[model samples]
Target chain A: MTALDTARPGISPTAAASEVEAQGRGGGGGPSRRKVGRVLTWLALTALAVLFIYPFVWLLSASFKPRGEVFDNRLLPKTFTFENYIAVWQEAPMALWLFNTLLVTVLATVAVTISSSMVAWGFAYFRFRGRKYLFGVVLATMMLPQAVTMIPVFLIWESVGMTGTLTPLWAGNLFGSAFYIFLLRQFFLGLPRELFDAAKIDGASNWQIFTRIALPLCKPALVVTAIFEFQAAWTDLMRPLIYLRDSDTFTVPRGLKSLVDQFGFGGEWHWEILITASVISTIPMIILFFVGQRYFVQGIATTGTKG
Target chain B: MAVAADTSVTDSPPGRPPRRSSARSRETRAALLFISPWLIGFAVFTAYPVIYTGYLSLTDYDVINDPSFVGMENFRALLEDPKVALALQNTFIFAVLSVPTQLIVSFFLAVLLNRAGRASGFFRTAFFLPKMTPPVAIGILLLLLFNGQNGLINEALGWFGIDGPDWTTDPVWVKPGLVMMSLWTIGASVVILLAALRNVPQELYDAARVDGAGWWRQTTHVTIPMISGALFFILIVDTIAAFQSFTEAYTAFFGSGNTTYSNDAALFYAIYLFQQAFEFLHMGYASAMAWILFAIVLVVTLIQVRVTKRFVYYEGEQR
Candidate 1:
C-alpha cells in the first residue's frame, strides 16, 4: 500500500487487489494514476492559462499593429510599430497624466504605509483604557462605503479649497486606512511577545521599538499594503473625476476618460489610441504583480484573519 | 535551592524600572503623533462635513447668499422629493441584486480557476485586469458590448432569434446593464477569496474523505470554516462598495434624444448627489443627503458586524 492508503483502511486493500488484477506500475498502480492525473491536470491548466493571458497579449499586440489592422483576428502582428504609442503620447496630455498619477500614487503610498505602520504599532502593543473600543471605532470606518462620504468629503474639500489640485490624492492617505491599520496590527500580534519584552528591558521607548523592531518584522505585510495602496491610488477614477476639474492635472485614469468624449469611430484618437493607452496603463500594475506574486499571495491570505 | 532562589530574585530587581509611568506617558504622546493626520482629516474632511451637513439639512444656505435655518424641513422635503425616494430605492435594489450575484459568480469562478491548477495565475490576472481597468474604460467597453445594433451581446443574442432589449435605452434593462458591467470587476474579490480558499487546511479535507465525506459535505464542514473569515470581510466590503455605485450609472447613455433613457432609471444616490452638489448647486441640501447616507451605512455596517459573527466560523472556534 502507498502512503496515501494509510487513511483508507478497507478500500486500500480492495483497491490494491483490483490494481494487482490489472498489471504492475504500467497502468494499475497509484503512481501511474498520479502521473496520468498530473498530465491531464497540466493540459487543463495550460488551456485555462492561455485563455486568461491571451486577451491582454492580444490587447498589447493590437496596440502596436497598424490602425487599419487593429481589429484583425491575426494573433501575430504583420506590421509592428511604435507609432501608436508615440502618437498617444504626442497627441494628448498622456505625459501629464502619467506624471500626475505617479506623483499621487507614490506619495500616497508612502504616507499610508508609514502612518499605518505607526498607528498599527500603537494598536498592537499599547495597553490603555478604551484602547479596545478605540480600535473598534477605527475598524468601524472601513465598513462605511466611500460613496456615503462623497458629498461630505467634497463639501469639506471645497470649503478648504483643496478640491481641484493633487492635494486630495496623497493627503487622504496620511490619515491611513482601517484595512492597513488592521493588517499591521495582526502581523504585530502574531509575533512573539519576548521580542517586545527584550526591547523594553533595554530601556528602548515605544518609538524605538516600533522603528527598530516591530516595523522591520512586519515588512512583508507592509510591502503588500504599499503595493495595494499604490495600485488603488494610481488606477482610481471616481475620486479624481469628482475632485479634479483642470485638464492639466488629470490623472491617468481621468485622462483616459476624457479621450472618449464625443469621439466617433477610428480617427487619430480611436481604437489604436485607446488600446495603446490601456496597455500602457496596465503595464506597471502587471509588472508589480509578477515581481511580488508570492508576497502578494501571502498578504491576501493572512490579512484581516482576526478582525 | 539557594541558587534557584537567588536566580528568581535576580530575574527582576526589587527596584524594577518604572515602565508603567513611562508607557502611560509615551502612549499619550504616541497617540497624538500617530493620530494627527487622521485627526486632521477626520475633523477637516469627515467630522466637519458630517456635522455641517446635519446642520445644513435644516437650513437654506447657498454659497452666494446668506444662511437661513429651517428645521425638519429638509427631512419632510426628502419625503416629498420623488428623486430622493427614487434614488434611495434604486440604490438599495441595485445593491441587493448585484452583491449576491457578484459574490456567487466570483466564488465559483475562483473554484474553477483553483481546480484548473497550472492555468490559475493567468486566469487570476485575466479576471483581475478588468477590475483594475479604469471604470471609464470599462464603461466605454461595456457600452460597445451592450449596444443593440452592432454590440457584441445583442449580436450573440440575435443568432438565437432573440432580439435583445435596447440595453442603453430601455428603462427595464438599464439597471441590469450596470449590474453586468459591475461583474467585470468581481475579479478583485475573486482573487481575495481564492487566496483564502488556499489556506483551507488540506489535512481537514483528507480527514473528511477518510470518513467518507463527499465534496459538498467536506466543503460545508471543513473548507467553509477555514476561510469563512475572509468571506465575511469581502461580503461586508462588497455590500458597502455596491451601495456606493456611481460613475458607471453616469456613463451609461443611449442618445441625447432619450435624455435619461426611457426613464431616469440609471440614477443612483451618488449620481444624484453629484447632480445636487455640482450641477444643481444645492450645497446645503446635498450635505444633508450626505449625513443620511452616513447613518444608513453606519446602521447597515453595525448590523452586519453584529450578525455575521454568528454565521462565520473561525478555524478552531465552536459555533
Candidate 2:
C-alpha cells in the first residue's frame, strides 16, 4: 500500500483482490465468477455515477440553450449561443456579486486558518490549568446550531453598526472555527514533541516555536483548513441573507437568489437565464474542487475520524 | 556513589532554571495569548448569545424597546399559536422521516463505493459534487426541476406515461419534495461512512465467509457492527442539521414571490423563526423559538446516545 493508503486503517478488499486476480490471469487462470463480478461492479458503478451527474450535465446544456429550447428533451442545445450569458450579465450585477463573494471567502479563509492554527497549537503543546475543560468547550461548540445564535449575533452586529455590510459576513472567522481548530489540533499533536523541546533549548519562545516549527511542519493540515474555510464562506447563504440588505453587497448565493426572484419564479419562467446564472455561480467552486481534490478528501477523512 | 550523586545534583543547577511556579505562569501566559482570539469569540459570539437567548426567551422585547421580563409568556403562547405548532410539527416530521432514509440511502451509497475498487475516488467525487454545490444553487435547481408543467422531472415521468405530482404547490407533496432535495446532498454522510467502512478489518469479512456467511450475512454481522460508531456520529449530526433546515426551503418557496405555488407548506421552524425576528420584528418570540429547538435537539441527542448504547459496538470497549 502507498503511504497515503496507510493514512486510514483498512484496505479495500476489491482493490486487493483485483491485483491477485490480475496475477492469476497472467499465470494460468482465476475463477470466471471473479471476472463476472468485476464486470458487474463496473456496470453498476457507471450507471449510478451517470445518475448522480445527470443533473449537472442537464444544467450545463440548458445554460447554453435558448429560452425557447430550454424545455426540449435533448441533452445538447439544438442552437448554442452566448446570449444567455450576455443577458445574465446585462440584467444582473454579476460582477459585484463575484467581488463580494471573493472578498469574504479570501478574508475568512486566511483569518480562520491563522487563528485556528494558533489556538490549536496552544491546545496541542501547552500544559495549563483547565486546558482539558477549555478544549471540551471547543468541541461542544460544534453541536451548537447556528439557528440558536442567529438572532443575538445579528443584534450584536447591528449594535456595532456592521449589520448591513459584508464585514459581519466574515468577521466571525477572526475569532476561530471549532472544526478547523479540532482538525489542526490533531495534526499538531501528531508532531514529535522532541522538536519543540529542541527549539526551546535553542532559546526559542512559544511564539517562535509555533511560527518556525509547528506551522512549517503542518503545511498539509494548514492547507486543508484554508480550503475548507474558503469553500464554506463561498457557499454560505443564510448569514448573508441575515446581514446583507443592499444588492451591491450581495454575495453569490444572495445574488443568485435575486436572479431566481427576477426571472424564474415571477409568473413567466426564464429557465435559460436562471440556469445560466446558476452555472456561473458553480463554476468557481467546481474548479476549486478539481484542483484541490486531494486536500478536500484528506480534510473530510480527518474530520470524520480525528478527535 | 559520590560521583553519581554529584552528577544528579548538577543535572538541575541551583539558580539556573526558573522556579516551577514562574515557568508555569509564563507558559500559561503564552497559552492564553495563543488562544485569546478563540476565548474572546467564545465569550462574545457563542457563550453570550446562548445565555442571552435563554434570557430573551423569558421576556418581551422588540428592537425599539427595552426587553422586559415576562416569565415564560412566550413559551405559554407557543401552546396557543397554531403556526408555532405547525412549524414544530413540520420540523419533527422532517427529522423523523428524513433521518432514517438519509442513513440508509447514504450507507448504501457508501457500500457501493467501498466495493468500487480503483474507481472509488472518481465515484466519490462525483457523488460529492452535489453536496458541494451551493445551497442557493440547489434551491434554484429544485424550483426549476419540480416546476409543475415543464420541469425536467415531470417530463422524464411523462416519457414513462406517468404524471408526476406538483411538488412545490401541493402541501401534501411539499415536505416529500424538500426531503428529496435534501437527499441529493447525502455525500457528506457517504464520505464519513466510507471512511468508517475502510477502517473495518478485512480479516473479519474473510473469517465470516469461511464460516459460510453469505454477502448479506457478512454485511449484517460484520460490517454494520464494525462501523457502528461512525454510523451513530453521522445520525446525530444529520438529525441536528435536519431540524435547522432553512436555506433550501427559503430559496424555493419564500425567495420568489410566487404565492400560487409556494405557501405555508414550506414554512419550516427555522424559516418561521426568521420571519418572526426579521419580518414581524418579534425578536423575543424568535429567541424563545430558538431555545425550544435547542432543547429538543439536545434531548433527542441524549435519547439517541442512551438508546444506541446497547447496539453500537466500539472496537475495544467492553459491553
Candidate 3:
C-alpha cells in the first residue's frame, strides 16, 4: 500500500491499482508523478488496444499482399490490389455461404422473436397447473452447456435425416435459445397487467391480445433476441461442421475452414484470399449493428438479468 | 377482468350463470400454443438427446457398428484412461489460470470504458469487437502471430532483445498461448458487467462520496457489491467456459498435425474427446469423457452458486 508494497516487483496491475488507490497515493507528487502516472496508464491502455485491434489491421493489409510478404511487419502493404477479393470469389462458393446464413438467421430470428414473446406472455399472465415448471425448464436449458448436448444433438440430427441441409441449422435455434426465452419472459413479466385485461374485456382472442398488445410492446426484447440470433447464426462453426457436408451449404465460418482444405498440400497459401473471405464474413454483422445500432445497447442491457 | 367472455351461455342450456371466468382455460391453451415450438423441440431435440446421452454413457456406442450394452465398463475404462486424467488436470489448470485473470481484466476495462465521457461507445466497441470477430478468423490470426519462423509477436520480442519461444511448437507455452487468445473476446462479458455497473443505483455512489470515500473505496464497497449479481453470473459462466476451451486450441496448435505434443501440453479434455469421437472413433469412451465433463460442470456450478452467498448481492431479494 506504500513504498514497501511497490518494492515487491511481482505485484500485478490489479494489486498495484488496489494498493495505490486504496493507500491514497495514486495522485502522485502533486503534479510531476501525477503526469507520469497518467501518461503511463494511457500508454499501457493504448498498447493493449493496439494488441486487440492490430490483428484485424494486419488481416486487411495482408489480404492484399503476396504470400512472401504476408509475414512482413508493416501496417500497410507495399502495394494494394483487389486480387484477393477476386481470387477468393472465383475459388469458393462465398455467395452460397452468405445466402445460407441469411436464410437461416432471418427465419430463425423471426421464429424466436414470435415464439419467445408468446411463451413469455403465457408465463406472465397464465396461471396454469405446470406453468412454473415449464418456465423453469426453459431457464434450465441456458445452464446446460452446448458442448455436453452437442454430440447427442448431432446424432439425432443425423438420425432425422436432416443432416447436410439448412433445416437442422435453423431448426435448432427456431424454437429459440434459452437466452431469448428468459429475456422475453423477463420483459413480458414486467408489462402492466391491465393491458391484457382490457384486451380480453373487448372479447379479443388470445392471439389477438398477443399480436396487438404483447408483441407490439416487446420491440426491445425482440430486437435483442434477434441480435443474439444474428451473432449466433453468423459465427457458428461446430454445427455446420458436422451437419453440412456440401460446399453449397457452408456458412461463412465453415466456409473459411474449408478454404484451408480446398488448398490441399500442393496449393499455395492464399493469405490475401483468406483474409478477404474473413473480412466479407464480418460485413453482414457490421451492417446488422449499424442498422440496428440503436437497439444494440438495449439488447445487451436486458439479457441475463432475470435468468 | 381478463376473463374470457361468457360465450358458453348460448351454447349451454341457458346456464343459470355464466361459468366462472374462463380466463384460466384460455390462458392454459395460450400457454400451450405459445410453447408449441419449444415443447416440440424440447421433446424432439433436447429431452430425447439429454436422456439418450445419459443412456449412451453406460454403453459402448460406436456409430460405425451397433452399440453394445456394456454397462459400467466405459465408465470404468474412463477412470483408467491416462489421457482422461491428463485432460482433467489440463482443464482445471486452464480454468484456474484463465477465469480470474479474465474477470479482473474485463472488469477493469469495463470500468475504464465506463468513465469515458464522449468516446465511451467507441472504446467499448473497440474492446468488445474481438468477441464478435469470428473465432475461425481469430484462429488464423493467432496462427499468424505464433508462427515460429515468421511471426509478428516474435519479431516484436526480437526488437526488445529477447528471443520469443516457439509458441506453437513448445509444449509449455502452447496452452498459455491459447489462454491469451481466449482473452481477446472479452466484449460480451465486459458489456454485461458494464450494464451491471450502470445499474448500480447512483444513490449508493452519492452516499459513499458523501462519506469522503475515494473511487477505490467507492468501487470496492459500493459498486462491486451492487453489481455482485452480474459478477457472480460471469464468474460462474466464465469458469465453466474456461473448462471447455477447444476450437481455439484445436485450430491454432493442431490444424493438421497429430501430436500429444512432443511434450504433451495442448491435449485438452474437449480436444482429447474430439480426437476420440471424430479422429480415433472411440465413441463409447468419448461419451464417458463427455459425461465426466457434464458432471464436472454441474458440480462446479452448484458449488459456485453455493459459495456465492457471501459475495453476491441481490438488491431486492429477501434476506
Best by lDDT: 2
Please report, as a residue range, the 10-residue window in candidate 3 chain A with the lowest summed lDDT: A1-10
Query: Where does candidate 2 chain B have its weakest 10-residue lDDT segment?
Result: B1-10
- DockQ each candidate and list the results: 0.28, 0.44, 0.28
TM-score of each: 0.81, 0.92, 0.87
Please list all clashing residue pairs in model 2, or write none if there are none.
none
Clashes of each: 0, 0, 0
For model 1, the superposed segments whose C-alpha errors exceed 4 Å read A1-87, A262-273, B1-23, B116-122, B154-165, B252-263, B302-309, B317-319
Worst 10 residues of 3 chain B by lDDT: B1-10
State residue B161's C-alpha deviation in candidate 3, in Å: 2.6
Q: Which candidate leads the pack in DockQ?
A: 2
- Residue A47, candidate 1: alpha-carbon lDDT: 69
When summed lDDT is taken over every stretch of 10 residues in candidate 2 chain A, the lowest stretch is A1-10
Q: Give the per-residue Cα lDDT of candidate 3 at B87.
A: 83
- Cα lDDT of candidate 2 equals 0.83
Each model's Cα RMSD: 7.1, 5.6, 5.9
Using TM-score, rank the candidates from best to worst.
Answer: 2, 3, 1
Give lDDT tens digits, candidate 1, residues A1-307: 1112111223442353344323322334546654554456456545645644555666777788998876663568899999999988886888889999999999999999988887787777867667788778777677655644666677667778998999887887887778898888888888998998998898886678888988889899889899888888887877887788888999987776666542422223266777787777777777877777666666765653454
